[model samples]
Target: MTLGFVMLVHTAFDRAEQVARHWAAAGCPVVIHVDGKVTRKVFRGFRDRFAGDPLIRFSRRVRVEWGTWSLVAATQVATERLLQTFPDVRHVYLASGSCMPLRPIPELCAYLDANPDTDFIESVTTDEATWTIDGLEAERFTLRFPFSWRKRRKLFDRYTEVQRKLGVRRKIPEAVRPHLGSQWWCLTRTTLQAILTAPDRAEIDAYFSKVWIPDESYFQSLVRNHARRIESRSLTLSKFDVQGKPHIFYDDHLQLLERSDCFVARKIWPQANGLYDTFLAADRPSRRVAEPNPGKIDRVFSRANGRRAVGRPGLYNQGRFPRQGFENGITAARYNVFCGFDDLFDGFGAWLARRIGGRVHGRLFHPDGARFAGAERVFNGCLSDNPTLRDYRPEQFLTNLLWSTRSERQTFQYHPGDTPEVVDFIARDPNATICVITGAWAVPLHLSDLSFADMRAEAARLQRADAAMTATLQSAGTAARLHHWTLADFVAQPRDRMRGIMHEITGPGPRRVTDLPPMRDLTGFPAFLEQLRNDGMKPVVMGDFTATPGGRNGR
Candidate 1:
């Protein structure tokens, strides 16, 4: 996912720097479009903050507005310039001064790489534009404005009355109905270019001319109008709290933020120096590099310094399992292990929520049984805004085999429906890994034989389980070497040692799978490693099986 970030900076210099520092660390090409109305002193000060890094782009200052079309104009123009200036860039994201990078840029980029042709512009159902939400609808009047905004100021209220009577419907074409939503997005290079060079540029431009707060709806509406396939959500993951901030990124919101798994978060306060520091501190353990701005497309393992990467690649069978769909083929070049579990433990589901709420090197998934996606469950601790309890289920035997890390960095996907895409993702990428069988169920795989009598039957089962998932990746042009392994064979082996053994059995293939890691290994990770290595049957340990994150979705 060769992504270039564009941040709309207004007055918050410190917040801009804070976000910049965080972004710079992720190794993405960053472009800052400061409000042109600001003084040179302001721009220069921000410039000095990133003096040496060449990847950081600074656009000619342009005045932006809160509810005006200027915001959209500013972002679109900046994005255009970036595309022209950096033709090689693959993805362009429109962000705000308050946004912060949630995942490492490389993982995010690799994800985008798997879905090349798709445009991630803001999109909603066609009727959403004229639809009502939270007791308000944009299309209710010939013109629509956020209800909160109307309530905030008397002047705006009067403006709404006048606008309503005037019926200023901005001459929307017969086919085009604008969806009023967040403008922030991560668009592919082609879409950004097409948007910039839209043939119906005049028509599109005219549509937003009279829309109140066109900035919020302009890009969102235009992209949908031109899109073949659109993701109807902003890439930035935010908490929807009663406080009604445009975004939810308070330091206190960390647990849910990590759980949500959206790559970037926005609208942070500049004065929260301690907050930024705390973020850096909390994320310190996951840091892939020691320096601030590393190179773009950071292959953490491939890096000369051999930095331990943080985010997990969602690859399995050479296919990747993102939130919406499955992608296959050598997803991430780096080594990554994603884990999952069976919902067997008492508090295991809740315990697992923490991991999904945090981060993962790959994906965080759970199983109803043989099915991959089923129900999801979060820890009871998380119910109170912030998750409290940790050491749940207290499986001494399990803990003894693993040392608890700072927090769970995982995501959960319940597989009641068939999604064979998981297998393809794991098989396509040789280095990518996944976990299965949570709680006590995953432990038996280590101790018993997991081979099946009827090979064709097993294949038939998997094929039927997720025909669409299987078809999607296979259609994408990648074949997988599918096989069955007995847990009895893999039991009592170090995970790394297990991989070597698997390599021998599977041969030098682009994609393959061996077995799931025992996440409930409370014994201690070192001990678990030692056990898995003892038999040379050990494969890569994706994660200890237990309740990780969002386990509550099991319903």
Candidate 2:
């Protein structure tokens, strides 16, 4: 499980030397590529610093330029050199001299060994919506810009604008769907080899040489097109501002850098002396190197179910069971039940679980339940002292929930109806049953909607999201039984009536009663209900709860 590194650097900074040392200490072979632009004296000084080290090798210098084909050429040179030198290297990581390891190298290597086939690269489709550069998708490949634009930035910008106005656009080569990504990545040896020795390598390189910022797109496009088991995520953490410049880390960002799941973080300024020591000191010890847990259920469930149950309990008790029911001695159950906020009817799921002899495992998304629970306790304490703070704002609660559960590194983005963790849990748990409770909130809906048209648009968006989620679940290869309980059907007398019913169902008193708004419209509800039915999920009004308690109800 040997790892290799291709460190691309221009200036022979002390930080680069430190980075090389770190990788070498981790038992990785380091291949350093000094930019051809650097002076002979500087290069000699760098080479002299690591004179007798067999693990370290220097690539043939390539004059690297920012946002040009030269950058890719330099990377290619380093990658090829590393492979030629260390043929047995399992994985090769492409990074810059400024990047520092966030986690212990052993842990990263172990994870890589576990996922040998997966390529850790962040890639997006060419038509990615979040492309920061204006006219990037079309202009990057279509515009023929001078390489000298790197030096004459202001003049080139005006020239580019004049060319655009003149309606001169170069057609991207046929059959090449341009994909873009971060320049840094960790790729399996097989994938890197494929990129270097690709059949269309010459043609692709020639085409990309004329493209703006070819370094960002060349490897990503080729690897995404070629790699068999690519995981679209980069292990390197980098922060980009509005202008698209990578943030230079200083002493203040140590806490954030420590919390990142990424193995490495980039653009550590050379001036930040002793920052490296601080990072090294805080690095966590590696976990036991072994194969990942075999069962898909075990992996996803263990991560999603939060840290509870230290040692294995009985097969039935291994799954999460409500504290109340387990304490009350309602233990005997044939099947496990996983319920979420939508499924809980004033804690009716727990009541139903006990009634039907099923163990109730709480929601999957609230993996940080304990954290939130502690925060809630503190909030309650504050309210007890100052009654004025007891505004009981639903929006406030929702904001807190999002903030509390948000991922430390990436933004917690999810489609409205897509709960992958929940879906995956049900798919893995053969004996598990899922109850999806659906209802519209009026207060939150009204607050969110600027007008009735906005409310309609919101309803349409939710409907689409729900449909997508339902499709995903139906496609999942699982025999687990699922039930959809629509609150609208149960209390259809009035719009406000359903809200009141939901309030009653999700209650234990003031604290249990959430400030969630009522449903904005009953229009999209029927479609979702019908889709559930079509997908073989039993759709029923809330009054039919008794008929479907536990695993008794089925399509």
Candidate 3:
């Protein structure tokens, strides 16, 4: 049986009519949930353009609020509309107006048909874990970005002005430490209906209203609880950071976006006509395949029936140490560095430890082992102050590294994934920056103490990318200027010299963080080295970090 399709959009775009036609041709139904706040002119524009397109169904307008429940509300309303309008719809996909389908329509249809039971959503649960957030620009959002005169609305104008003159952040409550996630999902009709018509619908709706990003987490959590047979992955393919936030679009990212074979690409600038047009032109006659090819990480969807355990680090990494969140303010503080990815970040943590004292924090991981060790430690120690994600995003990791360097405190990255892409990423950075090292001799546990030789060699390339990314902030004109400590010209530096590096990064005598937890965990200080200590084992230097209870046998 052919699966039904519904493409939901929150805004009006030039390509919607054309995209709708392709859906009609594929014998699928399209449901568009436009922002209720848009003007009537925009509504008529979409209606006229999509008129007579059988697959396209214009839903009642939904109001979308910024930094609030509006996104989830709009999605819920859209799902309800899609379900009510086309009850037989097999898989209702929530997408955006700017998204361009990469696979042939038939290919997408066939893939969905093959996997009917799988609810394709990146179902993540941070339940009582340390999270990390890359609000390196968290302060910026509290402020405001300058928009052109056209977007200078009287209401937002005051908001922006206040954001600039006096910083105002989104109200994050004390009791609720929420983890944000990807908003896109492709759910079965049964699952969708169950969520909309749940017996405790009011509670479900109200409970998520307080979530940081209800749109991303609500349905994801709902389905995971209700439906057992799930791929636990999202159909949408966009790179996210350690914070679990989606990657923003940049010029260098243009090629990367094209290679990402997922059905839709998003979070595009609302008015980047050239980029949007380029995306539409990637495939004209509609390339909407169901099953993604096994070629690239950009497009290839993992069919693994299971997921990395969300709250299982407690079982692996001693009793649950304090959870690190992605949102931890990366201000100038004494950040304890935790390096991960044995091959990727082994040595850099040691260098950082030398700066703040040789403290390496890590979690005992299985299968998807030391690949993201750095991220896990960062997450574990992050607590209530960060976004959390399982993926090893270089930007998020690097940004936090920059923050720690400025703070003059210790930070950690365990052995994170050692992909060439990450190496290329590091090579593109400058010496003023910090990262865990990668090499053949690096032990997974000593991810921090590996070697900086590769990073040092690639310093020039990384510096260039660092310079380029830096230019983005300036060109876009941000008030909060971000700085990086390029770790270059290593030969000239004094041996075992980070105080010099610290002074170079943050001018003037180092000021100890006036406020840090008085009671700190003992797992990090390479001196305390009591991480896995159990039996009376001979603690040598190399084995000190890995000495579980039963010496090497305990592991």
Which number leads on lDDT? 2
Task: For residues 273-297, write the lDDT of model 2, one tens digit per residue.
Answer: 6668865653556754433222322
Report the C-alpha lDDT of model 3 over 387-474, residue by residue, as the tens digit: 2332244344444444434423333342222222233333333321333211211223233442444433333333344344434333
Count clashing residue pairs in model 3. 107
Q: Is candidate 2 or candidate 3 better by TM-score?
A: 2
Q: TM-scores for all candidates?
A: 0.46, 0.51, 0.44
After TM-score superposition, what is the CA distance of residue 453 in candidate 2 from its true location, in Å? 68
| lDDT by residue (tens digit), candidate 1, 399-449 | 211112224322333231322335444445444333332212233233335
Can you rank all candidates by TM-score, best first?
Answer: 2, 1, 3
lDDT of each: 0.49, 0.59, 0.48
Q: What does the lDDT come to for candidate 2?
A: 0.59
Worst 10 residues of 1 by lDDT: 393-402
lDDT of 3: 0.48
Each candidate: RMSD = 22.7, 19.0, 23.2
